[model samples]
Target: MANTPAIGYKFDDISEINTSKDAWAVVATPIRLWVVPSFSGKKLPYSMELVLMDAKGGKIHASVRQSLIYKFQPLMNEGRVYQISSFGVEESRGDFRTTGHGYKINFQFSTSVRLVKDLPINRSPYSFMPLSDVALNNPDSYYLIDVMGILTGYSEELEFEKDGKKNKKMTIEIEQDGVRMECAFFGNYVAEVLGQIAAGDKNNAVIVIQLAKIKPFRGKISLQNAYGSTRILFNPDVEGANSLRQRFLEAHEPAAQVLNHLPNSGKISVSDDFLKRHWGKTVEQIKNMRANLKPSQSFSIPLEHNRTIEHNKQNALLATGSWGMRAWILESEVCLRPPW
Candidate 1:
């Protein structure tokens, strides 16, 4: 049972409360948390933002001003449920309201938070949008989406400028049920991903992001963090993460086994044109090229010719022990490279 409420306090659903009121009890889970620092990069009274979901399947944005953060920070834990009361309510602003609710919670120093024990935490309150349904052609600019998938790969962090402002972003590739897509994380999310990779905690993990905005690039849809409203959970202790991990492992096992026997399986940098030319071409296509070959030339002659211009690149990558031409060698009848 939850802690007994104060005498005058009464429970209220987050969906029902709109105006500035007092003494309403609300039991909700804190799904997301963010600390906003002052503009000068100083710690001058940082404010906090939270996305909370209640038992009745209602979600709303919540805020704790800088003055009260110190008093409430210790009591607030993301993913934990609490019975709270005596908080202010204000009409949620458009840019800040991630949920559809008309109002948001405003916590004060006098607000009370009593942790609710013995109940299973409900981490996911919204239905997730599949990668297949999201597309660049979709007209909904403000649509928020959730995604759960396996982290297949990632690119190096890129810094670029737009509108006379510099920003950092990274592209993350995620796959679900044979569908692969890219998502971009900006600012703090970028730092979080880099930190996890640095700590080696991202080796075999599923990433789940909530409330991401879908933006299109080059005719493809890309998910981006929705700033204050988005929540990211990496390898969370939830059933969805476990299921994704299992599926990812099962799907990659065959490739993993092949890599285990092949020491130099790392990819060498190649242009998109190169991959688009060779990656999906059947062995028959290369075999057909045999007729165009000179009588004395080996079947690998064309491949070697393609490599001639990239000789320095090949040598550089090979010297660093990261290039693997063996896969191509094994799959092809080309006699140019020695059998590994």
Candidate 2:
């Protein structure tokens, strides 16, 4: 008997696929995967979201929704190539689109997934965005972005009560070539980063975060971990980390030298000219006015009353400066520069 050769389904490039068809044949590498729990908090009703990259470096978003989620969840593994068919295609929606593709996949009851055991393509595509251009592309206000930078500074852990639960948070500031960005991590991430810093990891300066959400807080843009699917790498095996670290080292200065330039005194200066112009009086005249200020003389002893009035007068003199400037003076006691 003559042997018959089996025919494989024709696969379509992810970039070229759209919502025009009800079914598609897609063969792609799973670069990122996120499993979201159902709304009711049931285990069986969960869904999977993934970003798949094609051979030509094209990337698209695919998802396993509802009833068919359980069947395909176990089969799809990140960093593997699979030829999927009979899945529903629809227009990608929402403010946060993981991929730029106009269409995304929806796993149906008849969806078929077959993993390719033989490995040939090894590298996955990564579209890392620079910190400067983050504001331009992040206009939609909720897209997932990938960023890599050198760690410049971090803040102490903060504990806050939200919804009757105590949550821990930490903010890490990173810089790329001079541009700075801050990202806050909650819960386990706080511990994870603190541990890495404590261990004195050499690669602590180089950080790469994938599937991070862009958030604008108090007039500043912040990068935040998107939880489940998000991955954080310190000194990853990729060349990008090494390249950035080298650039940082070449331009880096000694820690003490950098710290010396920081402003240690009050930023606001009350000049003699400003006092004369605004208050119609000179600095010496103001000093005399404060010295002469007195409190109500009562049954209290004269010395005790004099002390109380002196204390109140000093407070009033301090109050002349703005609240923020007052706090700065108290902390560093940095003398204000005399504006001649």
Best candidate according to TM-score: 2
lDDT of 2 at 72: 79
lDDT of 2 by residue, 1-340 (tens): 1121115547787888887766678667789987777646576657788898867778888888766666877888788777777888888865467877787888787877777655334664568888878754444334678888877777777777655667777767777776777777777788887777667563336778887777654345677766666677666677577777777777776551131111111111234322321223333543445555564311211221122212224333221221112211222232343212
Clashing pairs in 2: none
What lDDT does candidate 1 reach at residue 109?
71
Residue 98, candidate 1: C-alpha displacement in angstroms = 2.9
TM-score per prediction, in order, is: 0.61, 0.68
**lDDT per residue as tens, model 1, 1-340:** 2444445556788788778555667878887787877745686646888888887778888889988888888887887788888788887654234677777788987787888765445555655776777752353434467788777777777776644567777767677767777777777677887677566566556778788876543355667677656776777775577877777787776454221111211221233223332344444554455445554555322232124211111121111111122223222332222223
Off by over 4 Å in 1: 1-3, 6-9, 20-23, 40-42, 115-127, 136-144, 161-167, 198-204, 217-219, 228-231, 245-340
For model 1, give the 10-residue run with minimal summed lDDT. 313-322
Full-model lDDT for every candidate: 0.63, 0.62
Candidate 2 matches the true fold with a TM-score of 0.68
